[model samples]
Target: MRIGELAGQAGTTTRALRYYEAHGLVRPRRAANGYRDYDEAELRVVREIRALLATGFALDEIRPFVACLRAGNPSGDVCPDSVSVLRRKLAEVEAYIERLEAVRGQLREQLGGAR
Candidate 1:
């Protein structure tokens, strides 16, 4: 299918598909006129990429996992080092959430005081 059709099927924008291609995540063949032609396997890969991206995984962090999946590796957690990366990301997210909560608490207090 074309980029538009693939994007529609994957529930994402064509620009996002192009970004994935640019990142070496998804590679589609070019037609004679230089149009992209995505196969079903490529479409599946796009879906997987979208899922990983939604999980807050960095592109660099997700690359090895994608490779493991493509290689039919039995264990998805083959990258032991990724555990530390995930931990750091989790810590960052937790810190962000705490800061947001503190801001929200202050806003609530200010609103109560004004009332």
Candidate 2:
């Protein structure tokens, strides 16, 4: 299929597809006339990339993981660096959850105090 068809199938715009290609996330074959020709596998990869982006993974962070994803299993044992990244992201998420919980508790307290 062409770029337009792939973009439509992936529920993204052509510009996004082009950006993904430029970023080395997805690669499409070029026709004799230099138009992009995307296959089903490319379509699947694009969808996966989109899903990852939705999850707050930076493009650089997703790049290594994308390789692991394509390889079926992420290669190598978890290094200290990888663990650190995971730990930091976890702390960030935990902090956000804690903040939300505090806000919820405050709301409940306010409601009770109002009554």
Candidate 3:
């Protein structure tokens, strides 16, 4: 498929696809006419990138997952690199949640005193 088709099927914009290409996240071949020629596998890669981005994963953090996918794994998370990234991100989120809970407690105390 072409870039437009991949973008459409992946529910993303062609510009974003180009950005992914520029960032080396997705690589496509060039046709004789210089149009980008994407393989079906690229669609799977695009979906994975979009899914990770939706979940607050940074593009750099997503590289391991992409590498895992490209390595012929059934899924991205099955690889050790991807698993390590998952663990790190989960820890970051957990720490953030703890900070937020602490702030919420402070806010409740402030409200109680103001009343």
lDDT by residue for model 2 (38-62), tens: 9887777777678767867666655
Q: Report the lDDT tens digits of candidate 3 across residue range 1-115.
A: 9999999999999999999999999999999999999998899999999999999999999999999999998788899999999999999999999999999999999999998
Which residue pairs collide, candidate 1?
A: none
Taking the tens digit of each residue's C-alpha lDDT, what string does model 1 give over 1-115? 9999999999899999999889988889999999999987777777777876898877876676656556665533466554566677789999999999999999999999998
Better of 1 and 2 by lDDT: 1
Model 3, CA-based lDDT = 0.95
User: Best by lDDT, which number?
Assistant: 3
Better of 1 and 3 by lDDT: 3
Query: How many steric overlaps does candidate 3 have?
Result: 0
Give the residue spans of candidate 1 off by over 4 A: 1-5, 29-39, 73-84
> How high is the CA lDDT of each candidate model?
0.79, 0.76, 0.95
Model 2: ten consecutive residues of lowest lDDT: 73-82
Clashing residue pairs found in predicted model 3: none
Question: Pairs clashing in candidate 2?
Answer: none
Cα-based lDDT at residue 35, candidate 1: 100
- Give the TM-score (vs. native) of candidate 3: 0.98
